[model samples]
Target: MPEPERKSKITASRKLLLKSLMLAKAKEEWDQEIVDKQAEKERYLSERVTPLHTSGLSLSQLQDLCRELHEKVEIVDEERYDIEAKCNHNTREERPVEVGDWRKNVEAMSGMEGRKKMFDAAKSPTGQ
Candidate 1:
């Protein structure tokens, strides 16, 4: 009825409409983002995942397949363990011999007189 009151009511209605539109826009954007993410996930799965070839197999057949695979994996793991153990044993057995040979070679190269000089130099305080 008065001019100021009508203007105030129109402003309030305009503010409410703007708020509702903003909320609707935000919800639409959020829904679009979720759809985009789902599509991306589906694309990634289609590209990266290898489909199993057990389509026609029964449950018993699948169980047998799984058991055979498990047995093969176990056999391969045991063989790997045996190989590793053999390598460790060989390394342990050879290390001492290799060190002894290296020391002998060094001694042979330096000779007794050189060793004596080195020992005297180490014993001396200034170590010239």
Candidate 2:
């Protein structure tokens, strides 16, 4: 016969797993929102705002427009950075150990030419 406590513990774990899955889905949605915000910012700035400015807005209007743009840009950037920081934290926490000595070579070579040499060596059979 199964223990009552064991059955309850399984139920609790199932609830936790469901909650975790929902949170992961929510994070994916938030990441998509960040991507959408970036695209909208780019499109609005390039297609709508720039053309409007070039089409002859008055100096005061342009100044006001600039202020509005700055505020919205700052807000979007702040939200993006916040979400990205959270996502980055999750990624860093979940990262696996690197497989090879690439880290050591990167540290040793720390320059463009040195990196090129390493890359060239990696491509050669003699180096292998």
Per-model lDDT = 0.87, 0.86
After superposition, candidate 1 runs with Cα above 4 Å error: 1-10, 56-61, 64-128
- For each candidate in turn, the TM-score is 0.39, 0.33
Off by over 4 Å in 2: 1-53, 96-128
lDDT for each residue of candidate 1 in 5-108, tens digit (9 for 90 to 100): 43454687789999999999999999999999999999999997767689999999999989987998899999999999999999988776433567866776
> Quick one: best TM-score, which candidate?
1
Model 2 worst lDDT run, 10 consecutive residues: 47-56
What local lDDT does model 1 show for residue 40? Answer: 100
